[model samples]
Target: MRQTKIVVTSVEDDNFCKCRFCDKKIAEIKNDIMVPSAEECYKNGNVPVPNFGWFCSQACAVNYETKFDINFAKTKEGKIDYYL
Candidate 1:
């Protein structure tokens, strides 16, 4: 009989607690309110861009920027174009 090794994967229950890959503390909340993930609060570049926060890092930021900005710009100009 041949014995096979089984690999077990562990997933942390707290998504907002820290980075699963990096194990970095995302945020510190004193109140009872829930804290947002680092990817949600900071851009992939680690910059805090409110209303559009995302995972901040070289790869993540570039991916998000190209996906959202470039794709949106490809669309026809809308009525609000003059304001922009």
Candidate 2:
């Protein structure tokens, strides 16, 4: 009989020291929340995980969601299109 050894891999840390949304300094790791950039939020059309509070912390994300149409448009051929 042969015995095999297994290795464990660790997840990469973002090390977010500040809250991207509120621009608040994170005193602790638990309190830290980092959001994506304005372009990312706009491209995704939604907020990503770890992004607490508002969207990308930029006015652009807010404007995109607020002023733009959030409705999903579909063509007669069954093609779907999302606008924001």
Best by lDDT: 1
lDDT of each: 0.34, 0.33
Candidate 2: the clashing residue pairs are: none
Which 10-residue span in candidate 2 carries the lowest summed lDDT? 3-12
Worst 10 residues of 1 by lDDT: 75-84
Best by TM-score: 1
Model 2 error, position 63 (Å) = 11
lDDT of 2: 0.33
Candidate 2 segments exceeding 4 Å error = 1-16, 28-84
TM-score per model over all chains: 0.30, 0.17
Model 1 spans with C-alpha error above 4 angstroms: 1-25, 28-45, 70-84
